[model samples]
Target: MEIINFGKGYPANVLLPHTLMQKACESHLQEEKKLFLHYGHKQGEEKFRELLASFLQQNYKTAIEKEDLLITCGASQGLDLICQHFTKPGDTIFIEEPSYFLVFKIFTDRGLNLVPINTGKNGLDLAELESKLKAHNPVFFYTIPTFQNPGGTTLQEEQRQKLVALSEKHDFLIVADEVYHLLDYSMRSPFPFCHYSKRVLSLGSFSKILAPGLRLGWIHCCSTLLNKMLEDSVLGSGGGFNRFISGQVYSFIKLGFQQQHLKLLIGSYRLRSGALYYFLTTILPDVICSPPEGGYFLWVELPKGINAQQLLERAKKHGVTFHPGYKFSTQKKLNNFIRLSFSFYDCDILEEGIRRLAKCF
Candidate 1:
């Protein structure tokens, strides 16, 4: 079978630069080998923290400092630690109806009720959010403002401001899942939540843009909340990260090889996204699809009365696969929609896969 798997959000075909590895190895060898091999600070490497803080301050123009950041195993861990520290059984949390699945699982397993609001083209429906907030009074509002998962839509500038206003008025923290913040295809950069850092808790990861094997992620928030979350992380998982991977990542960053690699990665994804969109527009004319401003996935709505799950079975028969949209919804109402990732396939493969699905529909 000629398989075209667009089911996951991993870089489809990129290799770790041998130069980066050699540099890291050289650095590790220069140091006391035992220190490099041993455990690191639970908060993460200070040098890495400095690098992140400088970048965040420059990009987001926030008041964030080194003390405000907490490194984690991945952004997933940051989300988990937040839930662990702030929420309890029966607590109510708010989320956009079509959000990332793991987020829904986290809240559900913690016994927290989720209030999901419908999102509009520009992003979360602000008017609906105000209405829901007034009625349900949730503990926190979760959002993926930049290249949001499943929908692959971005929150407009006005909506970003409105969300911050809503958080303040409702007296709730805004949990911003921003692991894909840097993946915008547009010339202009998307707005990050750090502008409202005091009220907005942001999470980011190297897993999406960089390599996931590094297992490095970080959380940004006010010192009070961050300290609390850090204490919990220490108790639960202990502070130091995967020591070897940390050293590897540190060396890569120090050598400045990842920067050039990132540009290449983005350029490749941009081409892939354009190719995927072209295929859908030409091949799957009947499918309702949104052109993502930036991100890996294309969110498509099948014709009314057609079941996305059923289509997935047919697609699998054609040796193509993508995630069913219902998985992203807590209420499981988006059964007509599906998410197809373009980052994992070349232009030819993407076109072929779309052609296969087009035949089935």
Candidate 2:
């Protein structure tokens, strides 16, 4: 099928380094041998945590310790674990209106009442956030701080500080999903929320920038809460984690190959994003697209009277498809918006996809 799928944030044009697999195989043969085939530990491997902690501290400026980090299958699972540990059924949580919808489903499935907070061009509006804090005294405020999903907007520096201040003032925790943190289009990558507050629980994953198949992610928090979370993970998932796979990843980082690979990937995506943005702006002038700071997506607001569903129907006929905007909103009112991912396809495919989308418009 000649398909142009701008629907998911999946990496399209990349492949996991064959070298990584070969290295993992070699490591398994040398390090674990028979033990490599066994079940993984629940808490994740120790070396992976240490490597991650050091990487985040050195590169991202987050003072994360090995004790403060817990590995998960990915950040998605980390979200589930956080919900399972912190909030109970009937507790209130604040979510960005146009959020990563999987979070909304997770909170709802766990029986938490969600209060949607509207985000502005720069990111979530602090005034609205404070109002919700006063109204609900929510258990936590969940946000995708950088290159936020669907909106592709990064939180401004002042706004980030305001969020931290609100969490402290109102005594609520912040669950930061920093999955897209490494995808920097910003002048400088924004600081993780934990830098400003101890109450913040930040989630990250290697899925976006690295191999999603790794299913490796981490949660970082302060001492007391992180201790409880680690305990919870042990009870919930059994032991530490997959020693074999984690060991391989740890080895990769120790050798500085992972960072080098990521830098190369980021450079490639930067070019793709620029080309995609230029194509869309030049072809679809009437559409309102966010100026992404650093992330894989462009949240385009179609012309006022255009029906996204109707456009999608026509676009599908031309072998191109994009996510409808309504899927990203809690209230399901953002019908004229759609999220386009430039991470997957080549420039030629992207050019064709934009052309098809333009025809729909």
Candidate 3:
């Protein structure tokens, strides 16, 4: 039998817009050759930033200007660039208890210590956060606020506002990973975190809404931060990251292809997430999992006396696999949990994957 990979958080091949991307590339390249084919601007092509700003304003329902944007190869690169400039090797950094697992590697690779803050379906535990804030002065609190990975939680608007205030009070930056912000399916998350303060740096990526292969993303921050990076050697020496890719994407957004593609992705993922949730509940009644309001993942708690890693071994034997929750933990604790992603497959495959998981149980 075929292995069903519910742990793989990737866009389905069917979901990728081949035609739209081809059209964008063909249309943009067919135009009069310009500086985009050369070293390009250090802060991305100006016209691309202008179009991105307008698209973001309409989608997020908030105001942002091109001056606030800085282009990067992708969100991961943006995070690494921030750490390189803004942090020291031994500085403490706060992250959600179960963050995007790959991000844990990013910070750890930079020799930064990771502190796990409590988070759940309701969002960040502010009381616990404030209590911890009294003890550690972190460089920044790295957060995935909307439809967060693994947890699928969205921090409320009020909490976000207060979080910004605390950031100012404590003098720590707010690094918001907002790649999943526009992938909402009936979820009304707060406005982009960068809007609340200049201390907040919001990272947006085309990897999610568009195609990951494009390797285009932007950091939304204050002019001070943008100017600092613009003058930095990483950008000044090489010019903008993904300049050519950004140029082609200018047409993608201009032609209204991004909006149309997002709508299709949202609709498809909604059905898949709901199907996975339904199967888990009906087939294995003991498992505790909430239906996601948006985003790609479903975080599930195993039944009593169940260990996720041990279950995974059995699941592999049954031709299904998922991410054990401990993989996402900084302290390696949440062994009774698991993360399943619904973006990679259809309902039929998800159902089979769940049934295979049930057999493992």
**Candidate topping lDDT:** 3
Off by over 4 Å in 3: none
TM-score of every model?
Answer: 0.92, 0.94, 0.98
**Candidate 3 colliding pairs, count:** 0
Of the pair 1 and 3, which is ahead by TM-score? 3
lDDT (tens digit, per residue) of candidate 2 on 1-361: 5888998688763545668657755765676545445555555666668778998887686577887787787898889989988999999999887888677788899999988899856678888888766669798989998888879888878888888888888888999999998878654867887887889999988887668888888888887777777667454555654455677777677767778877877877888888889899999988888666687899898888998889999999988999988888888878888889988888888888999888887
Residue 168 of model 3: what lDDT? 87
Model 2, position 255: C-alpha lDDT score: 66
lDDT values for all models? 0.78, 0.81, 0.90
lDDT of 2 at 297: 90
Encode model 1's per-residue lDDT on 171-247: one tens digit a residue.
88899999877777775655578764488889988787677766788888878887777576464464465555666
Clash pairs for candidate 3: none
Q: For model 3, give the 10-residue run with minimal summed lDDT.
A: 28-37
Q: What is the lDDT of candidate 1?
A: 0.78
Q: What TM-score does model 1 achieve against the real structure?
A: 0.92
Best by TM-score: 3
Which lDDT value does model 2 have at 127? 86
Q: For candidate 3, lDDT tens digit of each residue in 196-279?
A: 889988889988899999889999999988786777686777778888788889988998999999999999988988998999
Better of 1 and 2 by lDDT: 2
**RMSD to the native, candidate 1?**
2.2
lDDT for model 2: 0.81
